[model samples]
Each structure stands twice: as C-alpha cells, then as structure tokens.
Target chain A: MRFLKECKADATADLVYRVCPMHLLEPRELIKDLKQGQVLEILTDYDGALEDIPAWCAKNGQEFLGVGEDEEEDFYKLYIRKLH
Target chain B: MKRVYLDHAAATPVRREVLEAMLPYFSEFYGNPAAVYDLGAEIKEVLEEQRTQVARLIGARREEIVFTSSGAEANNLAIKGAALANQKKGRHLIVSAIEHHSVLNAARYLEKFHDFEVTFLPVDQYGLVDPQRLQKFLTPATVLVSIQHGSNEIGTIQNLAELAVVCRTQGVLFHTDAVATVGQVPVEVQTLPVDLLSLSGPALGAPKGVGALYFRDKLRLVPQIHGGIQENGRRGGTENVPAIVGLGQAAALVQGELDAKARHLSRLRDLLVAGLQERVPQVLYTGHPVQRLPGHASFCVEGIEGEALLFMLSRQGIYANTGSACASKALKTSPVLTALGIAPDVAQGSVVFTLSQDNQEDDVHYLLEQLPPAVERLRSFSPVWRKKMAAVAGA
Candidate 1:
C-alpha cells in the first residue's frame, strides 16, 4: 500500500501497468507486491473493484486504483503498477 | 445514430394523441367518477365511452371490459377466475408450456392451493402449439384452455381462431393472453371465436397500469380482486380514467394505422433480418417465417452468451433483449426458447429484437455493425465454445 502511494505521485512517470492474471492473485495481495515508484495493476472482472480498489487506496494512504473491461473475459487485463 | 430501441415489446412511448387525451383528465376532469355531481358524472361518462371504444376494438360488449392495473393482473384474473367459478364444472385447466409467468404461475397457484388439475401443452421447434394436442388434453373434467395469441419472446403468432373453434366445438371455454397482439395486430373476438381474452395498454401506446380482459356475455368469471363494486361490478376500484382514456385514443390510432404500421415494420424487419444473416454466420434465426409479428426478430448466435452480448450492445447504446423483455440481461435461460426444443447453449445465446415503426435502415446497419465483433470477442474467451471449436477442428 505504501509503494502504491509513491508511484501515483511520480510526476515524470508513465503508469507502469502490472496486470495480475485473473486467477493468480487477488487485487489487495497484488497491490502489496509493487515497489514505491512502480504501479500496481489488477486483473479483475468483478465490477466492485472499480470503486473498492480506489476507495481502499485512498483510506490506506495509497494511490493505486481502478479497473477497465474487455469483451473477452480473460483478456480483461486490469492495469495496475507500483507508483506510490 | 446514437442508439436504437428494439425493445418495443417491453413498453412503448405514449403517442401524441393519447398524451393529449390524458393530460386533461389528470387536471380538469380529475374528480372521482363515484360522485353524482356534474364534474364527476362527466368524467364517469368519458370513462364509460372509453370502455365502449376498448370493447369495439376487441369485438366484445362494453360491459365485458374489466380494466385492471396490468397484463399480469388481467391474466391472473382470467385463469384464477375460471378455475374457481367453474370448479363444479371440472377443475381441469390447460395452458401452453410457454405462457407468460402470469399464466403459468396462476395455474401453479390453482394447482397448489385450490384443488385444480393443470396440464401444460408443449410447443414444437418453431414455438407453435398444436391445436390437436390441446384437444387431446380436453377431457370431461376440462374447464378452460388458455394460450397466448402471440408469444412475447419467440414472436410466433398462434392461430387463435383455430384453437377457439376446437374449444368451442368441444364446449370448452377458451382464453388468450393477447397482450402482445391487441393493438399492433388485428384481434377480433367475434372472429377469433375465443370466449375470453386479455390485452394491455402499454404494449401499444397507452400508459402503463391499465389493461383489460374481454369476456363473452355468457362466460362467467369470478373477480380476482374484491373491493368496491366497480367496472360494472366485474372489477372493483376507481377507474383509471386517464389511462383508460389514453388506451381508447391509442386504440383508435392503431385501428387507423394498423396496416401502414404493419407494412413499415415488415419492411424494416426484413431489411434487418437480411442484413444480419448476410453479416453474421453461424447464427440461427428463430420464430415462424410467415406467421410472425412484423417487427420482431430473434436470433441464436452460435458461440456468445446472451447477457455478455447484451452488455456489449448496451455500451454501444443499442437496446435489445434475449427472450422476453421482462427476463433479459439476468442471464436466465428463456423458457419459451427451451420449450421449443432449443438446446441449452443456443437458448442461452438467443436474443430478441422487437422494433417499433420509428426504427429505420440506419438502426439495422448499426446493429449489423456492432453484433459480429461482439460475438467474436465473446467467443474468443468462452472456454465451452473454444473446446467445441477445437474438437471440430480436430474432426
């Protein structure tokens, strides 16, 4: 959660996207693996992640947040990386 | 260009004339019809006149028109009333396997709570029920036969006239849930020879919360809901004056434009069907070709799940359905399609489009543009489909 905070604040950085496989890791666990400047990406199809992840990051004093959908379920790569 | 409405079977926009007719009733003539004052009596007079208009549309007597809150209530009244009133006649009731939940559930209630025996007659591949099979179920204990005039999901138009004739010859009362057909298609109670019928206002251009049941003068049905003696004592409540008036005006409009609407919808539907078939391969078009509602199109795509496909279309601002308007997007398999002997995969992927007269060539093009990609994208990740494809490839 601490690393995600730094990555989101990095001004010169492009969003480093870390896409966890849908089955491999949960969003919270995956967010924990990122370095302070690297972004955290989550691959989740659960619609709740859109609001839950962002809200969790804000409360935990972290920056990693949000989701995107694909028509193909497995291809729905949630873009997350360690930033803050 | 932005979006198209192909869910007219769900509900329709109120017509300009119907809205005009209803606006005054909400304000100027808002007095209770039960009052004896001129203001109330005048509203009562208009309500009765509208009742007469509704009756004329269905070829029934004015007194036989019992207005209810909706199509489901009307259907419940028809099934339960006949079941209870004719209990002594015999408790045997027969209905189609693919009836709206209103009919099926009502029958279930009677079978469960009341001591009534219910038989559900099945449909064939095209969703058409055989009248002969219905006849076979009619024993001396048979009290009523209820079938839909047109299926909401499959769009197959049933031959009510033939079914009615068979029931009449057998001295059995017949009813039709004509909520899908009344205003859009020609429904003449006298010609159809049906003993009782149900129709909804919202299916055409009238407001929701208003529908009617048509019963022959001699046919007796107990009131499903008991309250104050209203609706000529057949149904009890303050009349939905504005909504009923709106229904009358809309029915008048339908009577005038029925042929034109039919022609326009048929042309648009054919255009859509031809374009979809040409664009999308491995898609099966369901519903009877000649005996179908003009604006209805239903298809079963080979590889995509319907809810996912519908969600994709929603993103593109195109509204349609898989099976009934009431049950789509919930990922529930359509009972109507399943009853037609469709397999689980095909039934799960079935989608229905019921267009209004206002839809055009652009809408068809838009759907054709969006659908194949949606199908391909959905198919790519579907494990069941991928496995089947791999097997086919190996074969």
Candidate 2:
C-alpha cells in the first residue's frame, strides 16, 4: 500500500470525485476543474482504477500522493495533488 | 445473509445431476474421442449418446447436432459459417435487431469483412420481430434469416414457427439462437421449421463452455474452425467430453421435467412481477406480459439508476441483472431496450429477474420486501428522480 503521508498532512482535499466504474472519462473531466496545488481525492468502486489513477496522475504532471481503502470491499480512496 | 439469485438467463448453477454425470469424464473416462483405441471408442460412444440425449430435448436427430464451446460460438458458426458457405447462392442476410451480440457481431463481421449485406429487422415494443416487417427485408438474394428464440434482457419469446414459415416460403434458411429459450420453453425442431438452432449448456443447468448447434439434415455449412475432422469436419477442436456429458444430463432433466419446472418458474416469476408492481411506483413492465419466458420478470423504474439499484440489491444479498454487462462500458441502458423504443432515461433503470425451477415464492417475497426501499434509497442520489419529484411537487 502507498501510505498517504502527504494526504495525512493535508487532511482536506479541494475536490472529491466519485468515480464510476468503466466510465473514468467523467472523473478525468472532473479533475480538469481543480487548480494547481489543490488536492483531489477519488473514491471509486472499480478495481481497475486502483492501478490506473496514479499512472494517469504522473502522465498529466500531477503528484501521486497515495491511496486508501474504504470499509466497503473493492471500494478505494485515492489521493492526488495537482502540479499545474 | 439470505441470498436470492434471479439471473438465470445470464447463467445458472450447474445442477447436481449434471455435475454427477460429468464427474467420471474428468478422471476415469479421460480418453480422447479421436484416438484409435478401446478407451477412445468407449468415450466416443458416450459422447454420441449425449448428443442423442441433447437432440431428443430439441426433437432433432443425433446426427444434426454439432457441439460448440459456447452459444456465442454456435451463433457465430450458424450465421457466419452458413452465410460464407451460401454466399454463392446469395450475399444478403436478415437478423432481428434484438439478437444476442454473438449473432449481431457475426453478421456485422460478415458485412464489414466479406461484403455481405445484412438487414437488421426491427422489433415491436415487446421486442417481438414482426413477420410483416421481416418480409419487407427479404429479397431473392436473402439466403439466411437469424432471429433469437427469446430476448435475454427482456424475456420476449418470438413466434419462431410463424417466422420460420415466412423464411421457408421465401426459400431462405432460418437460424434461431435458442440460448435463452431451448430448455426453458418448448423448442421442438420437428414443429418449428427452422433450419438451424443454437443453445448453450449453461442456460439449461450444465456448466459453461459447452453448447450445441442443430442443423437440419442436408444443411451444409463451411467449417468455422478447421483443423481436425472433429464434429464431422464442421467445427474442428477436441470435444469437451465432461461439459458435454453435463449438457446431456441437463438436457435429459429438462426434457423430462420441463412442464413441472416451467410451472414452478412461472409461479415464482409471477409472484415477483406482481409484488414489484404492487410495491414500486411507476414500474414499467419491459417485455411481453404473457408471451415472455416462464422464468423472466423484467422492469424499468421511472427515475433510478439500474447499476445503483443492483449494487444496493447485492448488498441486501439479492442478485439480479441490469441489462447486458457487455453494454456496461457505454451505459446501463441496453441496445435491446433501445430497440424496443424505450427512452434512454427509462432504460437506465432496467432490472431483469430471470428465475429458475429452484427459485421459490419466498425469494420473490424477499425481493419485493427489499427492492422498493433499495429503489427509493438509490433514487435519493439520482438527479433525474429529484427533478421528477420537484416537477411533481410544482404540478
């Protein structure tokens, strides 16, 4: 697990995205509204996005903070910090 | 947690009898039917016996049955294989708009890759392909007509006898993908006048990866998979002996107990449908009320998301399907629903309950008790529901 030290320090995200399974385009569109230095947390039930979001963050020039799991099975919490 | 499973159309639990029948093939009787030995001959005899059993279920000759890996493969072989083989006779084909993706994609593939012309015949609101509408599409060049025996999502059983008669009158070969109907409904090839039929084993209580294609005597098709002279050189591959054995047992069970099983399923299905109608408001029945599959109960609520409702139901230990998972990449709304002229918004709430002989009235009662609140809770998060409620309040 990627421990979210940066997210622990920040404690608050500027935006929250409830990602729909197989429909990541919606969340990708939502992320474009976030400003630089703002933290965005994505909560998703899709098993695939647990591996997908960090790579997407890196490619888009965003900081990959880490991920967290919710109490629900297969539901995940991912944190990303916008760079530009 | 009390679990209620109502997705029999997508798949069903492999019956105990089928599993028992298949057990020996996996271990003791593990011989290749192609080998030139006693073991092979014995295994081959059993395989042919199973074929006879399956053929009996559909009122067909044992020689006419060709084993396939799946209903999809059977459909592909039926549509593409037949069309490719008979292209010299004609290049045009007809299939219903609500056919399973296997048939639809096979037709599309032929159209795209081989310059074959395919006309997709539209269905009525209940998803029945009108014979008159189909007549308009049939030309002298139309060599084949592929229509499903029933709609998987909505559960509308077609009048295959009437449809096949139209095709026969035109001298066009008719193929019915009976994956959803064969065992559940009375599918007697002796009565239907269809040239080819497709069925998956899993749909009839056997394991997945085993299916059968019924070809009328003297009907010729170019082989889809060519290698070994298996399936009489029609489909080339090692026969799945165990799965086929399971299929045989499943078919025999269905053939013997079809009426009793159908009665049980219809009773449970009716209870669920009636319960949903009583409990849920603005629930639209999706398929033909009477002409549907005995086990199927499908509906669309006014303003809730089907995926959300399904998730909530899963949490409650009630399993059901929300349209085809194949179409989930785009949206929850099914092309089958759209073909029936259902609005996109209404189609988003589609939920199908396909019962089995095992399903009881208690399962139906449980679904009725749980589903209304689940829909209401999901509707609380739905923007469409909110808008509708607001509109109602303003009115």
Candidate 3:
C-alpha cells in the first residue's frame, strides 16, 4: 500500500489494494471531509466510480487524476489530488 | 384533548386477556417446557395447549408450528430455508414486488449470495399482484413462491389463498409472510392451501422478539438460525419464553374475537378514511380500497412529503407513519408503493394510517378536522402545488 510519493524514485510499480465503498457517506459529507493539497487514494467496490468520482471532484473543484476499475469484484481505485 | 395512534401495522399494545395469561408464567410456573421434571411437564402441557391454540387460529396442525425470535425470522426461515432445502429440485424463485422487505430482501439475498434465479412479479395500481403474471413466471426451475399476505405500507391484501393453490398445483413451495394480516384477519392455512406461513407477535398486541412459522405438511426445512436443539432444531437458540407465551395469549384473544374485532376495526377505519378523503383535497387512496386490512387508511397527500406529514402529525401527538416502508434514520420512499406502480410524486407523499380496536368515530372525525390545516400548511410549500393553485386562480 505504498503511495506514489512513497515509492523509490528508481523503481516503477503499481499497487493493487481493496477498499470498501463509501456509498453510505453522501457526497456532501465526502467533500467536507477532504482537504486542499492532500492526496486521496480511494478503493471502492463501486462500479459507477468512473463517472461518479470524476463528476463529484469536478463539481467540488478537486483534481481527478485517474481511475482503476474491477468488474469481477465490482470495485474501483480512484486517485484524486486536491487542488483547492 | 385529541391524540391518535394510527400505526397499528407497526404494533399494538397487549390485550388484557393476553397480559393476564402471561402473568402466571412469569411468577407462578416458571419452569422450562423441555425439562423432564413434573413442574416442567406442567409448563410443557400449557405450551402445547398454546401450540394447538395458535395452530387452530390458522387451521394448521399443532406439529407444524415452530416458534422463532421474530416475524422477520419466521419469514427468513420460511423463504430461505425452503429455497435452500429444495435447491436440488430447483434454484429459481418467484415473489411479488410489493412484498414486505423481510420477504423481498431475503429473496434478493438468495439471488445475490447464491445461484438462485429470482423473478419479482409486478403488482397493479392498487398493490395487488396479478395471478396471470405470477402464473406466467412460474417454471419448472421455480422452487418457491414468496408473497406477503397483506402489505404493511399500503394495506393491500394479496390473494395468497389463490396464489397458494397455484403453487400447489404447479409443485412449487409457497410461503406467505402474514405479519400484518395474521390474527387481525381470518387466516386458515389448511383452507388457504399455503405450504408455509409466517407470523409475528408484535402486530397482535404481544411484545416483540417472538414469531412463528407454520409448515402445512412434513416438508423439509433447513434450519436458518442454528446452534442449539431448540425449536425442534429447526430454529436454534434458547426460546424467548415470555414473549412466546404473550404471543400465544394474544392469538387466543384474536381467535375469540376474530370476526367481531375485524368488523369493528373496519368500521373505524372506514370512518377515518372517508372523513379524511372528504376533507383533504388531492388525496389519492392506496391499497385495494376494499380488500385491504381491516384497520388501514393509506393515502397520498398530493403536495406534502410523507416524512414531513409524519413529522408534523407526531408534533400534534397524532402518531401515524409513512408506514413500514420508512428506512433507517432518514426515511426512504415506500418500496411497496413504488412496486405498486405509484408515480414518485404520489409515492413520496404517501401516508399510512392503521387503526386499532380502540379507535373511535370521534377520534376519526377530530383527526379529519386536524388534518386539513396541517395538510394546508405543508401544501403551501410545495412548488408544484403552488404553481397549480396560482394557475387555477388566474384561469
């Protein structure tokens, strides 16, 4: 579970992790909990993350870097770098 | 001084006779029914008597009765237990979309967690399941058909007896969650032809934490809540004796007054329903209108949200509900209404009023009087209602 910054600069690796879907937490709650300049690595078993995460970040003025999806287990890996 | 309790579907207070029957069990003869001692045998005799009493209320053999922790458990046991036990025969199930969540969620779990195929048959505008639709969905792979006898939200009564006959002829297991309709209505399992029926105690004026499942014949049921040799090893764990006794007593009382009480409730229910409809505008009546539970008055106030109406009524000391479809903490719009083809506008604004034997005509009239003003206050805030009012005035 190494962050992108935590990895050795000389090494290239991708980390696979599993996280529970924050479906119970409304987006308003999620937006309030996040802060500026903090990197959020979320693991969610939510299929709609590709659309939901990016749309949510865009509405909240957060940067949506990339998304990883898992169809088998119905999960998602979303990377967000808070800009403001 | 006007107060109301229009949520009889949620619960009822224990009847005097029921409470009296339970008093001795607590103090006088507090012996385990399963023990071999003489006192225990006496307690066992009374328990068996209760078993027959409860069984007779539903026209089932005493041996078919097995008490459980709650109505929810009884439903789970009947639906899931039957499905799993008969999996070798088939892995498919059928049920009404308007079924209580206890049955609906159990079926959903079977589909999600297991390899069972589930077909949720749709209901009509009044929350009645069409027999033709159910018949069309039944296949050789269909192992069980689960439906609720009466809806807790809208109060529509399903034709379970007819549906049960359908399942019987087709060689599929039938389970009806009769939590809302049991005791209040004449439930004859033998005449009804249902294979399994679920009963809960709270609705019949007994305490919570007790219910029972009735299996008509010698059908195999895999134990759902397992651990001990209790409940014939079908539903394991120590018995909730006090509640069970209370439930038995309640059943006896219900059996004694079944016809008369039903008529009484219907009279009061109609009075409330008619008074409210005549007074309140844009009111949409729910359920089967006639074939519904004897005590329910379900309607949608055109403009006000169900939650808002419930909250306002609570403030007035008028305890009713948007009914059992309300979700955790923040309420959810009724799945039953949605399943019954109610538009979102009506479904979200729905309110359920379940009367009891105690409710009177004066109470119903006063409630009718109180409702118009409250509804007016809420309707004033609704954008749609406001716009419509403005347009009508201009016209």
Candidate 1: regions farther than 4 A off = A1-84
Q: List candidate 2 segments past 4 Å from native.
A: A1-84, B329-332
Number of the top-ranking candidate, with TM-score as the measure: 2
Span of ten consecutive residues with least summed lDDT in model 1 chain B: B226-235
Q: For model 2 chain B, where is the 10-residue window of minimal lDDT?
A: B324-333
Tens digits of per-residue lDDT for model 1 on B28-50? Answer: 88988867899988988898888
Among incorrect, acceptable, medium and high, the docking class of model 1 is incorrect
TM-score of chain B of 1: 0.97
lDDT of 3 at B308: 83
lDDT of 3 by residue, A21-76 (tens): 23323333444555666556555444555677777777878776675434443334
Which rank order by lDDT, best down to worst? 2, 1, 3
Local error of candidate 1 at B319, Å? 0.4
| Docking quality (DockQ) of candidate 1 | 0.00
User: A1-84 in candidate 2: lDDT tens per residue?
Assistant: 486533542323211212223224544656677777777676554567767877787787788788764453334668877788
Candidate of highest lDDT: 2
Tell me the tens digit of each residue's lDDT in model 2 across B111-187: 99999999989899999988888888899899999999988888899988999999999899999999999888889
> Please, what are the lDDT tens digits per residue for candidate 3 over residues B1-395?
46788787776787777778788878788888767899888887787787787898898888799998888999998888889877877899998887777888899999999889999888888888777778889998999998889888888888877888888899988998899888789999888789999999877888878899998765767778756545554666667667788888888778888889899989998888888888888899988989999988889888778888878887877888786833513566677777777777877788888888888787787778778898999998899789878888999
